[model samples]
Target: MFKIKHVLLLSFTIIALTIAGCKSQFEKIRLSNDVAKKYQEAMKLYNKKNYSKAIILFEDLSQKYRGRAEAEDLNYYYALTLYKLKDYTTARYQFKSFADTYPTSKYAEECRYLGAYCYYLESPKSSLDQTNTKAAIDALQLFINFYPKSERVADASKYIAALRLKLETKAFDNAKLYYDLGGFEVSNYKSAVIALKNAQIDFPDIKYAEEMDLLIVRSQYNYAKNSIEIRQEDRYNEAITYADEFMESYPQSKMLDQAKALKADSESGIEHAKRMIAEFQKNQEKYKAMLAKEAKADSTNTTIKTPIK
Candidate 1:
């Protein structure tokens, strides 16, 4: 019985309030005046930098007068309040919605700009995942296309460029760690190659891109050339192969000239060793002939001296 009485009272209260709500100043021609008073309070909070409170009041006003022609105005301000308060995720949603709902409004272009800015503001630090940054770039580009004459177009483009540069720097930074760990010069797994490949993708025309390529080639060459010489013939052939690869890759490279010259010197050194062995054998035979002759002469001299004795 008590629960039934409570339900009846709750229904009555809701009906009464709904009636009063329809009769309130909000539902009258003086609605603009009432809304203006409420907005004045919100503006005070906003101007004082109490963005949280301002956002709360603005959102209440926006919801209360949802279908009113002025609701669009209140919503746009509410989005701005959220942005100022650093509530970027919802701010982006609100700004994007406001732009769509009020496409012909004077603030539509700015709404699009702020939508992109909200994403830009939420972008993570460089060390963190850059999904937001990339999203921001895409949104900002869309904003540019939709509002090409918007004052914020340049600013949005600027943010995208900044984000891209940061992302590229992050990629390069990770690649550099490989070089730092000494993995680039001795193994097929050197870091310079990975760095160069990504660097080309991140910044194809970047000045460091060429340098990265050079480092990769140099590391590969050094790695192959310096492999263990357990089998002289095997190792020599591998070295020659690597040296040839280096030459073909960087034919105009200064290192290519040095590599070719080294190969020639290695060949000459091997030939010189062969010639030295042949000459040494010939000299050994000549020495044997001279020794034989000397021994013969010594015997003659010895016979002369001994017989006389």
Candidate 2:
């Protein structure tokens, strides 16, 4: 037991010494003024995949080596280190800077792609703000335009499509919100109609095109139905027009029956409004004729009562 304990103690001492020695070496290198040595060590750490330590050293060497011939290489590695560390926002800026400063470098094309990819990585979920998603699409498209033959072009195109789809989803949801809020304090049905129309114009090939078309028809119908009698005729006619367009566009849509039903209702409402207007005009003419008859009677009485002067 004594022999075994002695061996264990020696092993523990050696492990502690090794750890202390490594920390000491790192500290020494960190405080050293030797830029070349720091660059070499940073590269070594990066190769070992110790990115936490590597990034710090690379950041330091990046400044020390600025404006020198090694600047390009140093900046490239520094940006890569940040990427490997998963500091995507900083990585994006650094990579873009590297690409701009060394446009002719072999790494320039890759850096540009990485910078755009960082924006893609930063994109939020569909329900959240999509500013980063839009930025990603723009950046990726620009990258594709700049490097048509790049091996990464295919990937960039794929990401662009995904980001565009996200935008389409956001627009669709926003328009649907208007539809859901129909008949609120404001004339939200009309708002829904406008929103859906704008969404369709913005995303012509949206997946929900059929659904949106149906919503527009429904919204128009509701808007016309709730409008004051004076406005109902024109509004219902507008609804019928929207229904016609919907039927023509999506002949086989599952909502075809509903859309047709709305059209029929709108037509009925228009005819009813016309009849009401005609009845109102007839009553108004009768009122004017009664007034004329009363005036004539009053004049006859006054002439008969007056002396033959």
Candidate 3:
């Protein structure tokens, strides 16, 4: 029992001493006004990958070391520390500030690139709102334009392509949603056409270009077929025109047969409407002639009866 108690006491003393030493070292650095020692210690922590402790010291020294020869390096490291900690929003701001404040510094180009990259990292998934994705593209483009000859230009261009594709996907999906919503509470076919046309214009090189064009043809057909009889001829004629355009644009398309069928249906509809109008007019003419004959016969009979009287 005595031996066990002695060992337990020794272990507790060692733990206490270790904690005290750490506290003492932290206090010494925190209370010291020696800027050189503080700067050295901060770098030491940074190099050791103790970024959390390094950030505290760097934050304390940032304002204090302003205008000093070491200020640029200090600011660069401070921003870098934030980035390494994955505090991307703050890191982005700090990096941007570092670039603006020291445009001529050797670290300026890297800082600018990193600032834009932080936004890229923060971009949400494709299903979410793409505001951050757009911002990232804009920032990256600005970086590319500003540093056209930069070694990082290729990377910036690649990222811009990726972000633009995301926007393209979002637009395509939204337009498709309108198409799917057709024949519900409203005739959304027209809306689908408008949306798809806009998407085609906005993203001319989108991967969904072929699919969108086919959908436009389908939407126009549905819109025309659902109209009233009086308006059917004109609307169907428009559908025919769109179908013809699609054929001319993509003769080898897999949807070519479907587009042609729509054209044939529109043509048949127009012909049927014309025949109905012609038959109705012919019947009205015949009925009017018969009424004229009956009136003539009645007049003749009245004249003959009066003469006899």
TM-scores, all models, native as reference? 0.59, 0.84, 0.80
Worst 10 residues of 3 by lDDT: 300-309
Over 1-309, each residue of candidate 1 has an lDDT whose tens digit, in order, gives 999999999999999999898557333522444667778777787888978767767876887778988788788889889888888899899999999998998888888888898888888887888899889999999999997887787798899888887777677666655655554445443455566577777687554554455455444444434444332334334345555766775678756666676556445444554566678788999999999999999898877443554
lDDT of each: 0.72, 0.91, 0.89
For residue 27, model 2's alpha carbon misses the true position, in angstroms, by 1.6
Question: What C-alpha lDDT, on a 0 to 100 scale, does residue 64 get in candidate 2?
Answer: 84
Candidate 1 has an lDDT of 0.72
* Candidate 1: segments with Cα more than 4 A from true spot: 1-37, 182-191, 222-309
> Which is better, 2 or 3, measured by lDDT?
2
Q: Mind giving the per-residue lDDT tens digits that candidate 3 earns over 1-309?
A: 999999999999999999999879977997799878988998999999999989989999998999998899999999999999999999999999999999999999999999999999998877789999999998999899889999999999999898888888898889888878887833688888899999989998998888888788788777777765567788788888889989998999999999999899888888877787678788889989999999999888778443555
Look at candidate 2 and tell me the lDDT of residue 166.
Answer: 91
* Model 2 residue 267 lDDT score: 96
lDDT tens per residue, model 2, 18-77: 999999998899889998898899889989999999888888888888799998988998
Q: Count clashes in each candidate, considering only residues at least 3 apart in sequence or on different chains.
A: 0, 0, 0
